[model samples]
Target: MPVTAVDTDTDDLTMTLVGDFPAPAGRLWRAFTDPRQLERFWGPPGWPATFTQFDFTVGGRARYEMTSPHGEKSRGAWEFLRIDPENGFEVLDGFVDEEGNLTDELPTMRMTFAFTDTAEGSRLTNTTYFESAEALEQVVAMGAVEGSTMALDQLTAVLSDLRAYAEGKGTRTELISDQHVRITRLIDGPRELVWRAHTEPELMRQWMLGPDGWRMTVCEMDASPGGRYRFAWAPEEGVAGEPFGFDGETLLAERPRRMVTTEHMTDTDYPSTTNDLSLYEEDGATLITTLIEYPDKETRDAVLATGMTDGMEASYARMERVLLG
Candidate 1:
């Protein structure tokens, strides 16, 4: 997890937040500049954001809205004043109405974000200067502190996903057959690294744990065609229900290219499945295709209904962090 520290200096009419992420400055910089990435994490949890306008040049403007769980929308805008690659930028941030008109009643502030390299990773410091101490207090009273903290946390997750995609780990899924689900990802790293991450247990442990709060307690892999492998996952802390896992045997093994395996859950209603993974190189990026065949169409449909794709994509994003590291 990233560390976020927020400070408010009423005398200076400013609010400052400093955080550190285990990623490069360039990666973190994208989270701020890229519209797609910014929309994903610009708001706090339960209030997903959407960016309609993002012009990242000097004097450019951006308009976005964050929707709350209760179906309320809070719109905002930013006028860019400066742009610096891998370093930071300055913007005028303010509130807007549903019609995208700036709200005169709200206090607009000037925000500057600075990014720099650090021993741990990348350090981001944001200073928001208001016109007066009263203006600073106005935003703070509106839960700015908590909201910004949550937004930064979302930014960290976005950074992880972006890094993976940037490294050629972007993924897309399709249903090719009644019983098969195929997932394809472009990996920016070498095919060898992708192969090792899939075949090596130690490396697999770094990214295969389904989602956050889960850990692989058992990771056994035999890369040979006839070899068997088993992976068990449990909650980091004890949960209300029993832990679950899967085991399989390699059906085909082609180093740095392809592998076929059979997988079955240990304690679940889901049926067994077969996974065929093929890797190729295109323009120096590794293209990985994972085809999963379930026992039946019903089984495949059931898994998909459980939002399995989101979990798989999230896991792969975590894998990108491991590869980058």
Candidate 2:
């Protein structure tokens, strides 16, 4: 299923998800309300949630950990504002570090979750509010809304399995699908120039979002097997008029072409966005095809729908400039 989100200039943001679940409404409601209930259904089917604290009523708070297969982790928390039985609920969700320090960048604003009766099954609508335009843009780039859709899709199956288990049927294993990304680009420069743009720290920073303080603190790449690399790029703060370096990565080097990397942007609303970039030469130039293979399609589309394509194209243009400069 393709996951999607809204991109508009308004105070209200709404997302709707619908699926046919074998389990009843009450069961689904419990899956979301009870902390123990949530832990059972959170994360991608395999990556379970480790709940610290959870309360379903208004003003309640919950923290969770979703661990990836490679031992990487992404944490998030939500502040409950309302929980109206089986009909609906509302809360604000944002990023949290290992120590749970809420970053100054983003926070849980306000969100309303409504459950409706669909002919086939249930429809879930998640409406959110952001502090401003930039705030909305920030989270959109990080693929927040869409990831939840996949999480919930998995929830649907979880409920199905629970229903089957209740009926003495075997457990469900269809939810273990692998996620990946494919980024195909047509750069204006030659293959060597394209390679240099990504390999050189300063050049990578110019196009990629370098470190926050005009620094490339972690852009090391041996470009070989058994080699590891981490790339960081962000715009410097307090600059009168400077482009921001927003997205960066820590990559597992597979050399000369492919690598598994993590893209980190400040939104922190979602856990993590993993990417696999495959580079090759086409007609003397480079065709860098990147497979973003996100853990979920919703996260993929959420970030893609947010003009990420435009920004990345622009970033590539910047790479061209860096090469020419």
How many residue pairs clash in all the candidates, one count each? 4, 20
lDDT of each: 0.79, 0.57
Candidate 2: regions farther than 4 A off: 1-23, 45-47, 161-325
Q: For candidate 2, lDDT tens digit of each residue in 185-300?
A: 65645666676676666667566642224444455654443444565543456643333222445445433444555665544556567665545444454546554556576776
Maximum-TM-score candidate: 1
TM-score of each: 0.52, 0.48
Q: For this target, which candidate reaches the highest lDDT against the unseen true structure? A: 1
Off by over 4 Å in 1: 162-325
Residue pairs that clash (backbone atoms under 3 angstroms), model 1: 167-188, 168-186, 168-187, 168-188
For model 1, give the RMSD to the true fold: 15.1
Worst window of 10 by summed lDDT in candidate 2: 166-175
lDDT of 2 at 93: 80
Model 1 quality (TM-score): 0.52
